[model samples]
Target: MKKRSLLFPALLCASLTTPSYAMLNGCVDTTDADKKTAVYFANGILTSPYAAENMAFKMGIAYKNQFKNLHEDSSYEFSDAYNYSQGKLTDIAQVLQQKMDEEGVAGISGYQIYELISSGLNNDPIRAVLAAFLSTTTNAIYTDALLEELGELMTSASVEAIADSLMVNSEHIGLYEANLIAGKRVLIMPHSQGNLFTNNAVAAVKTRQPDWADSIDYFGIANPAALTVGGAGYVTADDDRVIGILSLMENVLASNLDNDPSALPSFFGGDSRSNTNHLIVEDYWDARLASRAVIDTNMLRLAQNTPFPLQIAGTGAIRASLSWGGQPDVDLHAYEPNGRHVYYRSKTGDDGILDVDDTSGFGPENYTVACESVNAGTYQIGVNYFRGNATETAKVTVFLGDGRTITPRELMLNQAEGSYGNDNPATMFEITVTDDGEGNAIYSVQ
Candidate 1:
């Protein structure tokens, strides 16, 4: 297609004076647009609420613009790009590819709303053009959520058709499990619905392939509201294979939809079910707690291998996995006044892992940690498995605890689990940090 004719740069100068924040689409308009590309509000057929839709459009626009700017001479024209040279279009595609290489992650759930918006565009030629430009390698979990939400937007028959397709296709992750597994990969869908869906998906998978069920990894929810009684019910009814992660913030800030002024029920609405999978709902807790456990001043340590001291802090103690071999025993070390000190170690039975039945409140298990106070220096925490202390299987953390704050640096996992942490285990560290800190530690998934 020929690139659309470009208006003079002077004529293209148009501004959109609006504030932009994270919306359901994960994009927003912070400034104005060019004459060719107007920065106007797009309701996106009202699938998401106006606030959410507006947010998504703005975010999408921002993402597109960001990608464009990274390319050479990425100026916009009022008309489409068909009028431009093949060279220009190729450049645009290359730029998008570079972006995916840099920013696109394998497992993350924040883009759920964005994925839904992209799926919506799948039906629209213009929208599809933009989405294709942005997506180079798609995360299967995220893509599935968007697809399912889009299916719901389609006729009722369409939703049932998709469900039936999932029920029959043994190869595909069951709709329930696929969604939950996606949650495990991406931490953005951190809600009860996401968690419930993950758990249900696991159950569904077990029914078909019990052997693989153990292999399934669980990613935690980025949002705490996803695990509430209501949120759990919604996701369970919608998709029970996935599990949601809960944080102190959710336990503290989550309010009844009827009473909270800031609460947006529409944002929380989803498939509702009374019965739910009984696998376990501690992925989020584990994600948060594992990170939290690192924060204990006593748990801090410096790896013996590293040259520079790495400071590590976590959000909370991670809920232990039943699949986990046993409670991890760790050796804590720090630079005390004179010589290297063995501050504290994971007690024999006092394995640091929180049990599945622990209360969701902020208590012993919430941000549990075992730290060794060195005089004041750098250190690392090395975790050793049962009697096999031959070599450190995993270096769980490296940190410095000086009686002021507890910070853990590393987390070594035995194997990847579904809904275990947000898409990125590294990013999930933030959730661990915020769970105990003051302020708006929690965010909503678009």
Candidate 2:
């Protein structure tokens, strides 16, 4: 593995210190500034700052190639037709309009045909023609090439080597402080394939300095790692090709971990998305950035909260409760996988029940799952402010069947503003249940 220079040398100098294993053995440093630190790891096929900088250029070429292939396979001037249909007129579109006029189809606008095809009105002649034009453009070839490339680059050994290289290179630069006090904050930003390296690196740290692990926070962008535990945040773009490919790989990796452990690394466990600390952004670039900015601004509030534990009363069951300190009416909303909304109005469902709906003021509201209602699926937990002032925060705690307690580190309701399920409503976290063998159900945060 090759070590690369820092993308922003000054920023690196201000943030990191070389790891001192000797200091971890015995020594005390009480004269360090309490500054926040953040480290970033770049995405796949990119080993250096230079490679990462050229990503936009490479993506442009890849998209061009993809469009060219789509046009060639469809054989209907797909790009021009699609663009024209989108209300953009080019020289090609003008020529096509002239041809349409000659062929007695002049009045049929591209937008009209697009709507017809999109709405599944295939019986219409124009829609049928447009649908046929698009149906021939397959993504099979592109997917195959992408999968092959990822398979070659994303091996356990390669990932470990990258981790080792990053740690080794950072030695002289100095980041890790041995014998540091608790609450010394550090954030790791790993994008795409860097997530693989980051996970392994954290696992390595756990083995070497277990007590120091909690001080680090992981903020993964488009992560593709297996076995993500707590104390991490993730961001992914819906339209990113690398994210789609990695998601497919993650499914296979997760299955193999359960059925064929020998085929993978001994350190490999399961997918990272099943952890309470993990967060998913379903939006595209700009929206994703805006969401991240909000999170980043509230990092201190997120890190400082001590999670309250929710005690479980039975095996294979889930119970969640919300409580606040101020005079506000907060409601707990739990959505089961079967589209069942368990709330104040509809408490009982096939899977869970809302036993306590406290609306009076500063009270604890609760929801629990019956023994027979335990099932393998994802449950979404949220908080709705039924009636309240603009400034109030709610504390949510979840108890799972597997003896795991999940309390979100940052679930502030400062924007509640006496609203229901609008922008102010906060989805605390999601829990996913699966069979743990031995006829038991294991619940994990997703």
Candidate 3:
């Protein structure tokens, strides 16, 4: 697939007005006093030095408000990047504004300034003025030189440095202190192109500090990364322009769609393939809040090496998968109507079997009961923290034999009272079974 033209030309020329102060201020109100950290990477259009800062500030505000709504007490410490080339261009804007004033080009918008520069490049007299200013400031011969450097910085080595610096910075170091003192975690958030940059940065970090890999979590929004699957959660909107473009590029590269390129819609497209790891939302803001919820709910699980649980309900079978994050050794307990209890000790009963028993780390302990083996009575499904820490969130998903899936239910364990051999495990969902005409059991949620 052909790469789209660089978007910086339009973004750089579009606006110069500073973002609103409300959008650039850090959020103060939070639920938790022991603050966590967030390292954010701005989108591709944030070519200006202050753009990342502005984006981060706005995100901080959104997070604060959203977390407050969710009643989460914890707060985030934000870190971001400043584009050096964009900084130089912002400095040169002052000179360009003075020249515009001398030429009596009053009320010229930001785009008009770039237009003047583009036009001046061909006229000797105008070029002389720009050249003089460039020599005094950036030591560049022409406008193209600055653009080329900016493109290089955005597309090459500096991109990785931008991602790496987030981890090695004072905020990251502070994470260690906070973790030791207050048991806090770090969340790495990147939007759009920053997602790609973050993917590379994480790869680099794994090579450098292999041990710190489990200490951080990643939440990518509007991501363009092609092979994003492990160790991160991704959220993308159906109407996001960047996601649309990326979807187009992906289709083109894979040749999965029709060859007629003209048939493709310009915007508001959908991803060709559904990624289980990526959550699809309505828009950018939705993606942000959804990713935040995932992070907030699974912060303890994400900091450990536990794979996100996968639940699939097969025809003619009822399955229940119990999973949790953190160091809790959670167990799945299914009570059948025939007085048989299926658990780790008694893996199989007449109705079903506890197929997998995970005793450590992130668990996807599974219980499967054949529809034919089920009796016509109510079945109870619950989870027990057999060992380890008790105060962890447990996810229970019930799959009916009719190919319908119950929404995964989450239960917070009472850390104080939870322990092994606790028969009174928290009930997550109840399943009732009745015999269809031919002795085949049918299932329904009770």
Candidate 4:
């Protein structure tokens, strides 16, 4: 066979679909990925929805740049979605500015700011903590009835509601059911308000699938929690004066993370001002002038020691697996573009393989994409009824890695319809892959 042209040279295709965010063919294969990548969640805040996410994403880019500087950045991929607490910045800045105007910056005290916040909350410091919690959680869980139930004490009802705000969060559920449940190794990098979210996400994983707990790595920045919900290491800048105020109260922030040798003293009375000492990008993630370098270094170390999933389907660039409603038998099949067929007889294909073949009930029999590679091509994914309950519904979950999302399709296998065997498998879906001429894979699903 002659060599295929590298997708360079500005290739043109008249019939091409607009690069769909909804693309990808998931080939099922075996093994762990050598090219390790972690999901760095950087989300938008209420005021500037993209700002916090950008700041959070900067941490990864900063770390990646450091790795690039040392020539060790060949194998990692970066991604984002994180919410920010910039409103705290506004509050802190306003308070600190007022204090500095009354007395010089040197006269400002964290305890003073804490007093102002406490006074605003009717002298209940616990109300300040609850206010902080409500700031981030308002979008998720909020009700007038709940508000009426509030008091100076952080009571059992408030704790339960806060837990509901965290554990029942949609984003947290997505991370668990999608990536972690699929068996991927991930480092959930969350900063500031995001640390609270990540901590709760870690707890949900531990409760549901403790076996996968070690596979999930975490690194926190500017945590405002009393302590980490997960035992992962975290960091905060030395002169992050907003937290300086919160540190005076044990229930509000993780004061222990405030010690950063690299962080400089604040230029202002308090370091909570945006684009300055309190920001995640400027104060925490930057390498040459901040503690975030140490934070990133330790996270990388933690990821290095973090064990890979002992289970299959937990690792992949793309994946497809079978789970059925009723009895003990359903089969997943993938037809890779290179004419390689992946099924029971030939488990391994040129691109991916069938690593799991279950004859038991409610199986997560998975076909993970071969580590580090999801070849360019069309994949026809289908399923067959091998034995047992014929009236069962079979589900095929396609985890499209590389910035793609997960899609699960189900088909009711009526045994009377004769939908069993090699050639007669039900076609769950199809995915097409092509190069976008810039070394990036463009995927589309049918």
Candidate 5:
């Protein structure tokens, strides 16, 4: 995986390395101090010192794209609705507004920064239009139900009132006092200091907000091992300098950040990598693992004198194979969900037959049955042709390919046959799968 230097070092040198601009009020400091500069021979032009500017632009584009995927209202306006349980964006917005009101900061700096970045990218005309709509209105909209809930959590004062207090009187740093006054209670990610607007603005919040001394919570979203050397910062969690911190429950999905498999820690479940914005979404795998119980209890019988749907189409070197591992051992078989045995075979000496496998002795081997383009979906995969356990747990892998080399399906089976096949022939067997549910297929029966 690629690595980035600590966010602070770059931030400290931003003013000296890049072009600096002064604001009318002289309140905002967009300066960079002199520091050691490195040169890259690949490009003749010197590297631009404006690190945060680039990140902001990229993050804005990502944010816009994510918003476009959501459902819209009757007029095609992306919903501004906020629900504590669902609309996370709206919730964050409300919180920011409430804090701003309490701190009495004129002209919402944080909101402006976030918007400047968002609008700067020019990816979404809709969002830009919406921002203009909100901008035109002088009164802040806190009509969402989530805003009410968050308001109740407040210490009996509105952010608007507190913001006024900070502007008029305060001995501490401007940002620190401002944050406490605004009722800042946001969860910040690590290595975020170089993000320009967010970093310095937060510092301003910390300095201006008195409550932050015992209200803030600090947390790291990345692995501790992933932290660059000397990256750790001191903040008293017990005293409220930092409130709480949690690891990436699965993978963090933000405007610009996604979990990369190459960057993942081995402890995370699944051979397949996933990226999610919320921890609840990341926890879905655990719920799935638990829900994988045998709801349809049926003994899987071998397909007999039947039309077995081979996943592969035209003839080549199509082969089917099955490999089994995990939990209890299970015999491989094939049938429909209604318990109709379609593929069954019999050994030269045995009375029962097998439907899917070509050779009984070729146990756990790749057997390519004749077939065609099997669309993606769940097909009946089973084990225990004649006599086998009714309720057994095992990991079965199916490999299918187009007549040549076999390709494996993404699904992994956890339970094979019912408790005991010999005792229960009326057992129900059906597994919900996706991706062309048919064709030349191999079963790795465990």
Candidate 6:
């Protein structure tokens, strides 16, 4: 239970922090395969996909403001990518609890966490379905009746988190490929769990395109990893509670943290007493000038290393981005005209893959047609209300890479209809394309 008590504050910082990027709320003064690309791969412990999205913009604004002050050229394409969604209080704790249960290692838990999870269970519908799917995926037995039982036990249980890590890291890697292939310089700064995602993505991308290394970079803020995946180094508070606690656990991968007796509290404001130091915006962001300087330094180096103007890898040849909230599970599906179907069940089809899926809530499950994989034909994209019925408002953004990246189709699903996204999904969008007479396919979203 000591772990439970210790975990509550860090958990509180994760789940309770609203979508404000600290003090830089300025009317946020305002991309492509060729624009200088900057992105924020956020930690998954957010309230919704929108929260993650907004946080990305806030981060961009904060950075842009600082970058302008530091260097003359402050133009860059900036966007946000949501980590796998765990929008509810219970969702995040469940992950933490499961980590401990599986590894039999103790770090974050106790009476306080018990209180948090107890209060969150009734409100969280996503984990039950998730448990059923995960359990069944592993050849275990999980009936509808068993879900309730498993749900209770899961407060103290955990699945092999490799699936979660894979889903998020792949999403990040996809962004890198999408942008870098588009001839854009990429800079991604990940916070907390995002450091892991960014690091993995960078390593993976570097492995694929070593010569492109100089074109991409990352800076970990409150970095939990001792090593920077494949980007610039990281800056972390000496007494960061989350980092401190994770460092002590064998099962948890985290950065080494050491407190300096004479270090000023203003620049690195991690407070063990208040337990409020885990938040990036409040703890670091631009508020901590010294650390902010570190981030800008990395940005400057990226500029020097990469001589491309800021560009956004927005909307690939065929991109389907789905986001929803207030429900446990809503799955995204893409039907390729090549007779290949992609969903959680069939995640990869042809060159299109469902790289990111959110069963926790506030999704952003995305399906992308690989950089050079656009076949001329009709592609159907849609969403299935997989579980929970709390009046889910699901939105889908289809980027045609032609001119319609902003066309969003929104749906209000009030019932949990299908367990698996069928050949023909309920909510849908259609994209039509024609191949060049010379054997190249050009597509557009209508």
lDDT of model 3 at position 23: 12
Instruction: Highest lDDT: give the candidate number.
Output: 6
In order, what is each prediction's RMSD in angstroms?
Answer: 25.4, 25.9, 25.1, 14.0, 30.4, 17.1
Regions of model 5 farther than 4 Å from truth: 1-244, 247-328, 336-369, 373-380, 385-391, 395-446
lDDT of 6 at 435: 57
Deviation in Å, model 4, residue 127 alpha carbon: 15
TM-score of 5: 0.19
TM-score against truth, every candidate? 0.20, 0.30, 0.36, 0.50, 0.19, 0.48
Q: Across residues 199-263, which tens digit of lDDT does each residue of candidate 6 receive?
A: 66787776755556667777777765546654367777666777766655324344433332234
CA lDDT, every model vs. true structure: 0.24, 0.42, 0.47, 0.54, 0.26, 0.56
RMSD of 2: 25.9
lDDT at position 388, candidate 1: 24
lDDT of 3 by residue, 1-446 (tens): 11122222222233243121111111112132433434444344324547666666765665655543332344444545322233433423322332333233335432343454445333434334434433343443337666555533333332233333323332222222222122334455665555554554455433432334454456676666554425476655444444554454232111111111122343534323233323222233333233445534543334243221122212125667776655648887876655566778888766678876777645557777654445666567877766664467666666566645465666666552445444556677778776665555566785
For residues 1-446, could you state the per-residue lDDT of candidate 2 as single tens digits? 11122222322233244221111100011132223222223343223435433432332332334332422221101000000111122222322222222233436543344344445543335423422322233334335456455333323222333333333322201122111111233344454444554554455544433445565555555555544546465554343444454344223112111111123433564222212212322221222234345334333233343121222212126767665545558887776655566677787755777766666664456777754466666677777767766665565666555434453223455544454352224567677766655446666785
Return whichever of 2 and 4 wins on TM-score. 4
Q: Which ranges of candidate 4 are over 4 A from the true structure?
A: 1-39, 42-57, 65-74, 81-184, 237-250, 257-278, 287-290, 314-318, 321-354, 357-365, 368-430, 433-441
lDDT of 5: 0.26
Sort by lDDT, top down from the best: 6, 4, 3, 2, 5, 1
Model 6 residue runs over 4 Å out of place are: 1-35, 65-75, 87-157, 160-162, 251-274, 286-289, 307-429, 432-446
- Tell me how many clashing residue pairs each candidate has: 95, 7, 3, 17, 102, 17
- For candidate 3, the 10 contiguous residues with the lowest summed lDDT are 21-30
